[model samples]
Target: MDHLLGEVRAAGGVARVASLRARGHSRRTIENAVSSRALTRPRNGWVAMPGADPLLVAAARAGVVLTCHTQARRLGLWVLEERPVHVAAPPHRHVGEVKRDTHVHWARPLVPRHPDALVDPIENVLVIAAACLPREEALTIWEAALRLELVERWSFERMPLPSSARDVLAECSSHSDSGLETLIPVRLRFLRLPIRQQVWLAGHPVDFLIGDRLVLQIDGGHHVGAQRRSDIAHDARLTLMGFHVIRIDYVQVVTRWPEVHDVIVRAIAQGLHRAA
Candidate 1:
């Protein structure tokens, strides 16, 4: 009925027939609803209310569940790359049709997945991402997951992680302000420099304070308007106080990484990341 359509809409306009039945709609009611054009059976066991998420519908048709970076991005978790539809299937199940630009995973899942799930479990997604992505890149996503409480730190600790993955998690700080904040540590970790995060200075919390007097301010896409002006004022105050501030945006931190690296290296050579 009306409640059923609302549920369907809430569930991205599509749901498993079994789920509808479990929600107290009788089998006959479901059939009648479909017959009355109130719901449409998109697949053998799935019903959709007019317009479901096209991506999810396509994934369902392909019999592949979204996983790794793809699922992370969809869940609003931190992900460096966005292209290529990443999907996963159990080792025994046949995945979707082979196509260019489609990244399919056939590895056994670290966590159990429901038979009809259209998306991989969050833990599974992180595990796969940790193993597949560069250690530093993976750290941001894991840290973001931890910050959002989407996944518990203990859960990752309980999972069997390789030495490399363990190292990444060990450095994952829940205190990171954003994915870019997490990236600062990972990218600069190899330098063995003393780094502090979320440091309080002049009545504002800066993203990172490196060594002694250097601060890093990471700005995400929405870091504009009053916040941006306030940050600029803070930077001026910090500079006047003999603190070096390096402010960068998402693209400079995530995409133009080498440029960021060179800047950091030169700043270190100039002793900018240290006390005067």
Candidate 2:
């Protein structure tokens, strides 16, 4: 059993219990380790160390395209909302019978070859992720995938998508946002404010731009502690450069869109009026 544990650890920190069993680990040994809390069952056939992230374990077990929020987080994408675990299985595989909490979507007529391939030779998880994620979340994943070079833009372009999915991708391609950033732009657009999405300022990225001077920041919960402090310092630096910075939190962006819009509109009007 100790030898089996070493083998599992060497295989990227995850392995299927069935694989271990096939490799000569006794059922009694498996049960004992699981009972001792030395191992955890992330999915039906997969088991890992107690501290392993469940998402990674599941992806490793499925042996197919594990993506969307799962891949985004794995690739270190800045994701705001937690989404269901999405996996793309081969067309003939009976993923539906797996009966796990994950949302498994089967892909019929698989692509000839995935563009942004993984080191493990898995199909382009990024493309599957982009297809399944919400429009806003997809955009965030797409940008992160590009920055990491995990997948190419052509991979997404090449997939055969339903009309609705294609439309969502088209609209989202022009704007990059997680859920929080998406809210800010949607609110600004509804209020008829001239705002640009993902505008770069002084080497830092701002969520929206109101003309040349005002930068809009959407602060999600993840932006706390050291990150929060860094953001404050960046805002101060922008202020020193004669730029106005308006920051809003997730609650303001989600529940108080009108109030948020009014505040930004007033600020923009004031800035423009002063410039005039």
Candidate 3:
């Protein structure tokens, strides 16, 4: 019983009752774990630790699994939204409010889902997300998956893609440090201008170098103290070298896109991104 409880906790505080039985624990032991309050049967077939994530438990109880953005967020992938629990069920299954707010996805997964699995596979999540979210956001998740080593680029390319997913994946780049890093180039791809990533300059690397002289820096919240001071000093030296450095923060790139776009356009108009 102790082993079973520990195993459940190790499995993100959740496991199917059958999984415990398969692990050589008898039915009686599972019931005993529940009786001892070390685990709770959130659904008929699922046993979970007391601290199991409520959203996942709810998905289990509702006979569905987390998918798309919801599963991406849970997997520690870069995600921009965190609301309205996104779940996947069989195309025929009817959902009736798992545990308050929910967004039920009816799109059939590109590949068949595992019958006993309670979480969407990473590739399936990306496939469904490609069809559900706008191109840029979907590509961000795909790039994030690539960045995190959650999936390999060649294998993902080999997988079947429906709708505009193939086109979206074509734009995906694993070179980005974050989803926000991807955002800048993806949003500006229409200009047909040269954009280089992780460019070496002044004995350091800048995020993006447009044309020959423009340096576009996407600063996440992590830039601080010595790192921040170093970046500032680099910005000064780059300017002295006749490079135009345009630094923007998370909010500007993610939330206030219009302003960021306008600023970039003005910079280009003034030939800041051109060779001096």
Candidate 4:
């Protein structure tokens, strides 16, 4: 029926037969619809509309939910790098079959997953990501989540996070404009110097204001054409205003960090971070 097709489409092009039944559809009706090719059985009890997301369909087939870093990336958070497809199997239950490229998370979820859900909630994504990734990499995603208002700081207090996750959360702040911005202050925290993020200066917001005068700008992929020109003009203006500027690109921040670190250190050694 058209109504049955609508229900499946509303559930992101996929629906569980049990859910359809709960919605007052009969088993015979569902079977008839499937028999007429109006819906597809992706797995035993799951029906997918035509052209459903292959990944979600695959997850349903595997009896898991797309989760962890994979879900974080899907949510537009700042992830350090791409990894294999990550999924969470129901705790204490055996997953039937999954793609070899899939990374399965078997940990108990901090938030309960709905039986018909194919994607993990943002909270579960962060907690699982924190446990799975390295300390700093996980912190990047956490800060992005905070910055984007996806999760509140106090919300995590009630959850049973492990020590490592707690440690990472302690370092997270919503002030970070991007994952790279988060990385900067965290890497320089050992200096015990005053650091601020997204500070207004020279009529624009700079990525970071270290100490009193140092302005650090991280240029991501979007810094091209008009944006790039504006950034350069702003750098000139900030320099004229007596603020030290160190503008680095994505590669320098992610791949060649030590070099960037040395530059910042040398600038500090010369008191570039201090007000004249």
Candidate 5:
């Protein structure tokens, strides 16, 4: 009985009764555990340990996997925005009924899903995300996945990904330090400047180096306390070395992008991006 509960805990606080049975637990053992209140049924044939994640329990109840942007954010990838919880229904199967606000992805997975799995793997998440999010927003998540080494690059090359997804994956660079690093260069590409990312200068990496002399630093949430001081010191050092520095925060890069864009344009017009 303890072993039965252990099985459920090892499976992320949830397990299918069939899966438990396959693991050598008999139906009577499962029933006894449930009868003793050691396990719970979120839905038919599914058992969850006490204090299971509500979202996973809900997914089990609905016979779906948490996927797309939801899973991407779960995996710590940078998501452009939050939306309704996204889930993927099993292929060719009805989900019966779910909340009307739940965004369901019905496309076949690029990777096969395990019957007992409650979350989509990174590959499936990326594929579904590509189909769901706008091109650039999806690219940010893809690049972050690569940068964090969540998914192997070889997977992208070999997976039978749709052309749209393939195109976005092709643009992904593992060197991007964050989603902002990915977003900055791609958005600035229209200027036809030689833009480089994660460039080493003054013994640290600048988020971006444009043309020959301009350094762009993007300050995410982590850029506070000691980190903020370090960045400010770096900006001063870059100035001493005859490089132009433009540092922007998360809100500036995301919400007030047009104003940030104008500043960069003005700096370029002054040849700040050029070596003197």
Candidate 6:
């Protein structure tokens, strides 16, 4: 039993006790380890010790595609909400089989699917999670996803998402975050903003371009620590390159959109006047 526990810890500190039992570990031995604090039971049949990420252990025990906000965070995709475990299984699968603490979604399979599609990629899971998140949070996750290239524009367009998803996508179109950055083009159209969604100027990708004069930046707060310093340096460089830059926080784009609109309009006017 100690040998089994040692092996589990070496392999990332989590293992299914049931799997161990199947492999011939005695039930009494497993229970003894649990009682001795060598293993901590997070869910039925699953245990983790000091070395494993509990979330990963939980996901492994469920035996389905771990998804939504949970998977998004795991894959380093930007996530706006901290949800409990979100797992997606086939429609035919019984939800009762899942542990009580998990939030399970039985979804229709995504189409044109490859073998890899059985598991929700970080991008698809985030799109689903974003649909459930607050509009602002969804936008941040979207922008971050785009910057990271986790999702592509065409892939988002092609998804057979529900109406609820479409509504979220429309809201996310104008918002920016790594979570759903792929939807920026769609969002800009919804807002009727006559600006390029992503344009390269002065060697950095600017979020929105209102002609050659004005550049709009969508600042995702998570990146703020390092990004704030980078933004300061980039703004100085843009000033030298003869482009007027206007920056907006993720909150402003979702909550105070009118203010963001007004700021952009004023900046564009100033930029045009200066150019002339």
Estimate candidate 5's alpha-carbon lDDT, on a 0 to 1 scale: 0.89
Cα deviation of 8, candidate 2, in Å? 1.8
The global C-alpha lDDT for each of the candidates, from Candidate 1 onward, is: 0.81, 0.63, 0.84, 0.88, 0.89, 0.64
lDDT of 3 by residue, 8-95 (tens): 8777777888777888989988988888898888888888889789877787788888999889998888887666778888788776
Indicate which candidate wins on TM-score.
5
On lDDT, the candidate that comes out on top is 5
Tens-digit per-residue lDDT, 200-252, candidate 6: 77778887776666777778755577778988898899888888887777687
Error of 5 at 183 (Å): 1.5
Q: Which segments of candidate 3 are over 4 A away from where they belong?
A: 94-97
Candidate 6's C-alpha runs over 4 A off are: 10-13, 21-29, 41-44, 50-66, 82-85, 92-103, 108-127, 130-187, 191-194, 197-207, 218-242, 250-256, 266-276
Query: TM-score: which is higher, 3 or 6?
Result: 3
Better of 5 and 6 by lDDT: 5
Full ranking by lDDT: 5, 4, 3, 1, 6, 2
Candidates 1 and 6 compared by lDDT, better number: 1
Q: Pairing residues by index, what is the TM-score of model 4?
A: 0.90
* Comparing 1 and 3 on lDDT, the stronger one: 3
Query: What TM-score would candidate 3 get against the native?
Result: 0.91
Q: Tens digit of lDDT per residue, candidate 2, span 76-178?
A: 7767577666666666764323336777667542354231121122224545554665555565555555555565556756867665445644655346556
* Candidate 5 structure, TM-score to reference: 0.92
Model 1 has a clash total of 0
Candidate 5 structure quality by residue, lDDT tens digits, 183-229? 88778989999998888999999888999999888888998999999
TM-score of each: 0.85, 0.57, 0.91, 0.90, 0.92, 0.58
